[model samples]
Target: MIDISASPTSTTLVVSGDLDLAERDQFPEVTARVTGLRRQLVVIDMCRVTFMDSTGAAFLISLADSSRNRGGAAVLRGADARDLFVLEVCGALELFRIDRDHRCDDVPDAVEEPSIV
Candidate 1:
């Protein structure tokens, strides 16, 4: 599941559970619901996401592109190492602005889960 909190200039998406194709069906609706008419910095907190597939990667790419088109940036935080590997293998790491070293000002406090379970 994903919990979205939209502020006036930013939106925080707390992603939980597996981000596989089976669960990506709600991605569009969730984004549409959380995104307001005005531009917003989209911060995707993947602290609780356990797994991800190629479909999920594509969804994230699309989300980032869509947000950028609206003059907003998309930030992915606390992505699992496995997911990072997937992106690396797919040569899609550049698509997302990974928030590791420097975090955007609008990013909410993201308590990352343990990578090893």
Candidate 2:
């Protein structure tokens, strides 16, 4: 289960989901769409992401590669501790722009629309 959307001004892709084996297939389509955008910011919002597997990690790496190829930025926001650890353990954390903000004690039930952007 994944919810993916792109920012209109920048090439930011907001993603929220489990992103494990069950939702791996949707990532490529998302990357394809985000990589073709005209903007330079590919911000992947992971605030609502609860799980991640090796396949999901690979998809993120691919997205980073594509963003770099286009000379854009790939920003990963609000990754949970476990998922961040997964990326670090896989040595994929350095490949993208990541923020480890866990200040909120209460996480939303779902990923809402990009109201901040």
Q: Report the Cα RMSD per candidate.
A: 5.8, 5.9
TM-score of 2: 0.75
lDDT of 2 at 26: 79
Candidate 2 wrongly placed segments (more than 4 Å): 7-9, 100-117
Candidate closest to the true structure, highest lDDT: 1
Q: Which candidate is the best by TM-score?
A: 1
* Count of backbone clashes, every candidate in sequence: 0, 2
At residue 36, candidate 2 shows an lDDT of 68
Candidate 1 — which pairs collide? Answer: none
| Model 1: residues with Cα > 4 Å off, grouped in runs | 101-117
lDDT of 1 by residue, 1-117 (tens): 888887778888888878889987798887676555445588888877778898888777777777888877888788757777777677777767777753333435444423332
Alpha-carbon deviation at 98 in model 1, angstroms: 1.6
Error of 1 at 81 (Å): 1.8
Task: Give a tens-digit lDDT track for model 2, residues 26-104.
Answer: 7777777766665666667676677788888888888887877777767777766576677778888777766544333
Cα displacement (Å) at residue 36, model 1: 3.8
